[model samples]
Target: IAKIYTDKDASLDALKGKKIAVLGYGNQGRAWALNLRDSGLDVTVGLERQGKSWEKATKDGFTPVKTDEAVRNAEVIIFLVPDMIQRTIWLEKVKPNMKKGADLVFAHGFNIHFRMIEPPADSDVYMVAPKGPGDTVRDYYVAGGGVPVLVAAYQNVSGKAMEKALAVAKGIGATRSGALESSFKEETETDLVGEQTILVGGIMELMRASFETLVEMGYQPEVAYFETINEVKMIVDIIHSKGLSGMLRAVSDTAKYGGMTVGKKVINEDVRKRIREAAERVRDGQFASEWVEEYNRGMPTVVNGLKEVDNSLEQKVANELRDLIERGKPKK
Candidate 1:
């Protein structure tokens, strides 16, 4: 069985007096900075430019500093910047200014696993990846709960990398939920595979295809949207809070029977094969290479894809339905 850690398994001693620098003031960075400080750890927010992020950090009561300056003074440095920019920032600012043997932290293993941002051998490289978005993480922490997290160590030059990782997880309130021990490769590959196969790509395609099928079958677009898209959240919420069988039991007998029988027909062996192919692309680094290349070329594919989605009939229908629903809601 995989090792699971709780609040009892972690200690803040490793981070008590350490000067921690959090690079970026975006979603994850802001959450980490706030949570760690709330846990009584010293945190410095670092930004590349004195722009909106810097202003936001200052508003949050952090003495924001330049990236290089933060790295130079900190014993621990957390990189919360976007993956595409990490390599450039590390090379130009962090790598040159980071203190020797400083603990390097990450929320995801992408850059490290892909060798896009390789830390020095002397540093303690680790990850404390919360299992949710930054806003969710912060919300749970404030509510006296926490999102689960994955803890991993890449390099342990300090011989206490895992300890420090757990400590960071605790500081962020992740230990309140649980921290599952993982590795860089495992976390990176699984995250990519899940995102491609189900979370982002698969779900969107499923909804779009379902909507198109209903529309082609002569159903009203609004009705199709309600059935194929809007009710997904309600069903997913049930599944999230309960097990699959529980979700099945909660629905109508017709739904249970139809979903169990016909659902597999829709997502049959061909779909499984395609999903496996996507996993292979992620495992073999093909997806990473393609994404990196796309990013370098200014993300034309991503931009055009978003534009296509924005102009889609499904999106237009969704917007109209949402506006109508909002207008019908009783005002306070």
Candidate 2:
């Protein structure tokens, strides 16, 4: 079983005087820098000299130093950048100046587990990933609560690397919520698969198929939009409060029976086989490897993916769904 380091074990003294560098003042980076600084730790924000984010970081009262200098000066370094560019940034700007035995941390494990980047032998490598998005993490912490987090120490060159990781979690108000232990590989693979299946890929396909089916059977495109995509939130709300059985009980018996019968046929043996295949593609890293490789070749994959997700027909359908939501549902 994985060990979850809880709040009772966290100590502010653990990072009291430690100089913590937050590399990349993006969403996670900004929140971490703010919370860590408020906790009285010496914190610095590192970013390239360009970009509007530099001005924002400065206005937020952090000395936005060059990447190299920040790594050299801080005792602990947290990288909060995008997954694809991290390894490159590390090799170019961070690797050289990283202090001996400096604690190198990440919000995601992409670089470490995949051998995308290797830290110097003298550095301590770790991760402290929030289970939620950046805004949720920050807002919950400000309210004296915290989103759950995952922490792992990949290398302990500092001998206290695990302690430092836990302490940082405390600084960000994670331990008071919950922080589970996971390896770099486990977190990385699971995160990728989760995004590929439940969050992005599978959900998108399900909505598209549902919409097309409704519209093909003579439903108006606007009605199809409401019946298929726009009601996703209502489904999720029911699922959130109750399990599938409870959700079934809450719906009208006619709708419940239809859902039970038609949903099974829609996701029958062939579709279930396809779903398994899709998950296997993620497990084999066909998706991640392609994404990262495309980045190394200048992000053609991201460009294409964005283009597809934003095409005209999809945009029209999405807009119609938004309008339907605003107009309120027709008489049930």
Candidate 3:
């Protein structure tokens, strides 16, 4: 169960004196450095000496140091590296530098829950994962808004796990909107399944299969683009504006009726059962194990899957649609 919080719960200034080391100058790292610096905290970005992000961090007014130096000094160590690489870095660079009772934090629970990165015995392990992409999180902050956040604590070695996690949420500006507490396992599982099944992996396959089905039946590429890919935004916009029924209300009654009738035929109980079974795999940690194993084996299949996407015709069509959308943007 997650204990969620709003703005009144605590103030962001609680981390004022802490030396925060954001390991890895990637998406979450940069955004956190910006937000935490603006919040009047001592913030440093840890990066490889030869890495491009060091220059970017220095340009943005951050103290950029090698991973070892940063980790050794910071009172709070925030691991913002990629999931597959974090554990290795932790074993090599982080675990040794951590002092007793320092806070170990994360933006996501994948590495922690998968046991990829193990923390020191005396430190607290908690999370403050924003429920959006890194760009969205940064953009929201710029607009004086904030994205929803999920905070989790797996350890309380110093009895400040929950409080420290909340402090982290505040530091990153997640408290401007709200934060929810969840288990490391739940957040990790939901996040992975959400990516692997619906958002990226499965949705791409579904969209391509649908478009291919239309084109193989003699639909024009332009028409298929409009109906399948181009209109995706329109459908998504309506879906976001309102629920599924609201989306139907914005469509033709015939289309709605056909959707109600034929949609079930296409996505029947068997299909739903398969989805449930997949969910079961997630709950049972099988999905995490498989993904971790794939990573450990040098990510051959994962690289191949990415190549499959790059070579996809759908990517080509999507790029064209994106260009048209960009072209229609108002002149600066």
Candidate 4:
């Protein structure tokens, strides 16, 4: 079994007294900076421009510095910028100014695993990927709980990479939940596969297909939205807190029987084959290459896809329903 760590398995000693720089001040960066500071660690926020993120850092009590300057002064640097921009920033700003033996950290293994941002051999390279969004991570930490995280070491020049990784995880309160030991490749490939097969792509497509089917069957769009979209959250919440069988037990007998008997037929061998194909694309680097190429060409496909979704009948119905629901809510 893979190693699992809790608060008892980690300590902040490895990170104590070290100057840590958090680049980006965006989603993951802001959370990491705040959590580390609350944990009594020195954290410096780095930004490429004096924009909204820079202002946010200042409002949060950080004297944000330029990316290169932060790299020059830190013993540890965490790259939390978007994946598409990391390679450019590393080559131009971080790589030139980073301390020779400074530790490099990441929230995801994408850049490293795909060889988009290769760190120097003299530095320790590791990852501490929280298993949820940054806001969720921070909220859970504040509630005296934590989101679980995966910790991995890509390189161990310092011979203590894993120790430092665990310390970083602890500082961010991830050890309060659990820290699962992993490798860069395992974390990267699995994350990609899950996102494509279940989390983002699969779920969106499933919802769209269900909504279309209900509409095609002559159901009222409002009723279809409630059944196919709105109630998904309720079911998902139950499944998240309990097991699949628990969810089945909680629902009506009709639901349980129909779901068990018909769900498999809907998601059968053909669907499984498509999911496997998606996983293969991720593992074989085809998806990465396509994504990078799309990014380089200014993300036309992504932009157009979003526009298509925005103009869809389903989206229009969703917006109207959401507004109606909001208007009905009692004022605070």
lDDT, residue 312, model 4: 90
Better of 1 and 3 by lDDT: 1
Residue-wise C-alpha lDDT for candidate 2, range 215-298, written one tens digit per residue: 788888777776777788888888877978778888899998899899898778997787677767766768678777776798
lDDT against the true structure, per candidate, is 0.94, 0.82, 0.81, 0.93
| lDDT, ranked from best to worst | 1, 4, 2, 3
Error of 3 at 74 (Å): 1.4
Which portions of model 3 show Cα errors greater than 4 Å?
A: 1-3, 329-332
- TM-score, candidate 2, is 0.88
Screening candidate 4 with a backbone cut-off below 3 angstroms (N, C-alpha, C), the clashing residue pairs are none
Candidate 4 residue-wise lDDT at 72: 97
Residue 93 error for model 4, in Å?
0.5
C-alpha positional error of residue 10 in candidate 1 after TM-score superposition, expressed in Å: 1.1
**Model 1, span 101-127: residue lDDT tens:** 888999999999999987898999999
For model 3, state the Cα shift of residue 180 in Å: 1.6
lDDT of 3 by residue, 207-311 (tens): 787898888998876677778776777798898779888999999999999989998997789878877788889878788788788978999997998898787
137 Cα displacement, candidate 4 (Å): 1.2
Q: 124 in model 3: Cα distance from truth in Å? A: 1.3
Stretches of model 1 off by over 4 angstroms after superposition? 323-332
lDDT of 4 by residue, 1-332 (tens): 99999999999999999999999988888888999999999999989999999999999999999999999989999999998999999999999999889999999999999999878888999999988999988888888888899999999988999999999999999999999999999999999999888898888889999999999999998898888888888899899999798799899999988998999999999999999999899999999999999999999998999999999988999898998767866797
